[model samples]
Target: MKLIIAVVQDRDSNRLSQALVWEHIPVTKLASTGGFLRAGNTTFLIGVDDDRVEKVLEIIRKNSQVRKGWMTPHMGGGNEGDGSYPVEVQVGGATVFVLSVERFEHF
Candidate 1:
């Protein structure tokens, strides 16, 4: 068995979750926040057989798309040299981790 952990932007969470459900892949969703951008995110936990891992991954890739966004970083300690401007950043993608499960049981 494999455990798939996917963290995706909030904007794409709903669509991704819907697609997973449509494909009959059970998923658990949790509210999360990104450390870098302090932006809203959603974490999905999916348990599936090894053979089905690729299908789940493909669904995530199709639903979560990478896009550009702007963010104004906090400059600690008021300094004259610190530029407080919105910088373009790449966002809206899923960070996934596949782990081998020693045992899985459902009641």
Candidate 2:
């Protein structure tokens, strides 16, 4: 069996969850926060057979998308303690990890 852990931005959570449900893929959603941006995120836990890993990944890939964002750094620039400008950043994507599970149980 495989345990899939997907961490996705909050903006895409609802849509992703809906799509997974539409495919009859069971998922457990947990509220999460991103460390870098301190932004809202969602963690989805899915357990599936080894052969279904690719199918689950395909669903997640179709739902989660990457987009641009802006964030200001805490450090000052140019010998001044105040030139903290917001920089365009890549955000809104899923970080997924697939792990082998020797045993899994549900109640």
Candidate 3:
């Protein structure tokens, strides 16, 4: 067995979950926060046979898309220690991992 973990954007969570379910894949969703923007995110846990690894990855790949992130105003352009450094950044991206599941139990 393999455990598939997917970290995705909040907006894409529902769509990704639905797509996984449509493919008859069961998953667990957990709330998460992004590192850069501290934005809300979703982490999905999927358990499947090793043979389905590729398929699961495909679903995650389709759902986990990179989106533009908000940025603050730029500071310290000329002034030193002005306490403001802002610029546009891209933050919405995703990561997926597949690990061996030696044992799994549900209560």
Show where candidate 2 strays beyond 4 Å. Answer: 68-91
Candidate 3 — worst ten consecutive residues by lDDT sum? Answer: 69-78
The best candidate in terms of TM-score = 1
lDDT per residue (tens digit) for residues 1-107 in model 1 = 99999999898999999999998999999999989884899999999999999999999998887877887776454665577877898768999999999999999
Ranking by lDDT: 1, 2, 3
Model 3, TM vs. native:
0.72
Model 3, 54-105: lDDT tens per residue? Answer: 9988877777667566665655255676666566676556788888999988
Of 1 and 3, the candidate ranking higher by TM-score: 1
- Error (Å) of candidate 1 at residue 8 is 0.2
Best by lDDT: 1
| lDDT tens digits by residue: candidate 2, 40-105 | 999999999999999999888877867778887665445556767789887668999999999988
